[model samples]
Target: MNDQQNLMIKVVLDNWYSSVKRSDAIFNSLTDEQLLQEAAPGRNRGAYLMGHLTAVHDAMLPLLGLGESLHPELLEPYVKNADSKTDNHTPQQLRQFWSEVNEAVASKFNALTTDEWLQKHTSVSAEDFAKEPHRNRLNVLLSRFGHLEYHRGQVAFLKEKTD
Candidate 1:
């Protein structure tokens, strides 16, 4: 990639990181009690949403060629599975997972070369990706960043209940 391309990629990553910081602020502001409470009258608890976000981010590890997911256990309860009374993890544990997963992802993301950003993701084959080049590492990051923002908004709604 040229200087211009690298700068563009940097800007996108920066924007995504800014949203992650915003989500972190939201996570930090919630007490354990608040995390177990609903954002609205009838929705998933804050704790569930937090775990869901962590699980989704963890799934992106392999998607970006950044190695395996750090928390596959989170997949069922928080990803493939929906919110229910059965979620066994505590708010504290989910918060820890959230921080560690995001930190690891950021580290790997930062370590990528310009060429790596254009490479096919882990799940996509070179032949398939050649035909559909949009399925690249940078695109994966962009998609997940949007996912982060949507859940961040959901988590933010919990403050309304408190206020």
Candidate 2:
């Protein structure tokens, strides 16, 4: 890669890393009970938000050709019980879960290559790649970052309400 391209990739990765760190700090301030608490009547729990962040990271890894899966098992706990009128994680479990997932995501981000970052891949389902267009790796990465930020905001707002 050219120096400029390398620099750009570094910048992007660095920004993502910074954001994740800040989000993690915010999450760390909450008790496990708070982490699993629902923000509102129909909103997601804090654990669910963390799980969604982790799942998106896990899902996008293969698309980037990184050849590693992250937190596949934990995905269901975050997404499956939504709207079920029950909480899925205890406060302690939520804290540990977010910590583990956040660590995995940071590790993955650190290991990404410039070539991988620029590659294009289809986010098609098992049966749909032939019919769907490919998405750029950069776009996918940005989307995940944005997704994390979106959930972070929700969690932060919930923290305020709960506090």
Candidate 3:
């Protein structure tokens, strides 16, 4: 890649990490009681949302051609259904899982090269990606960043609850 291309890739990655850090701020603001409290009526609570975000981040490992998940068991419990028992795990355990998984996601993301960010992810073969190159690591990062922000918005109601 040329200098400008390399710079652009780093810019995007940096912005993506910035967003994750902002979400972490919101995630860190919760109380043990707030973890179980619903961010809003008719919605899943903070604990479930934390688990779901962790599961999503874990899925990105294999998707980014990194490696197997550190928490594959989280899939069914967190991703397969949103109606999981709110008390399935203690608040402290859920908080630890959230922190651990996000750190794992960041470490794997840092291992990728600038060119690899433009390459097709593990889900698409090179031939197919050749036909549609927009489906790349950069794209996944953009979408997942949006996913984090979306849940971050959901959790914003926690502050509202406290107010």
Clashing pairs in 3: none
Task: Locate the minimum summed-lDDT window of 10 residues in model 3.
Answer: 154-163
Candidates by TM-score, descending order: 1, 3, 2
lDDT of 2 by residue, 52-106 (tens): 6766677665666666665667567655545343565555665565677667666
- The best-first sequence of candidates by lDDT reads 1, 3, 2
Count of steric clashes across candidates, in order: 0, 2, 0
| Candidate 1 C-alpha lDDT tens digits along 1-163 | 7999899889999999999999999889888888898877888899989989899899988777789999899988987876885547988899899999999998998999888888888888889988999999888889988998988888898664543
In TM-score terms, candidate 1 sits at 0.94
TM-score of each: 0.94, 0.77, 0.92
- Candidate 2 wrongly placed segments (more than 4 Å): 80-85, 122-134, 161-163
lDDT for residue 83 in candidate 1, whole number 0-100: 85
- Between candidates 2 and 3, name the one with more favorable TM-score: 3
Q: What lDDT does each candidate get?
A: 0.87, 0.69, 0.83
Error of 1 at 94 (Å): 0.8
RMSD (CA, Å), candidate 3 to true, equals: 1.6
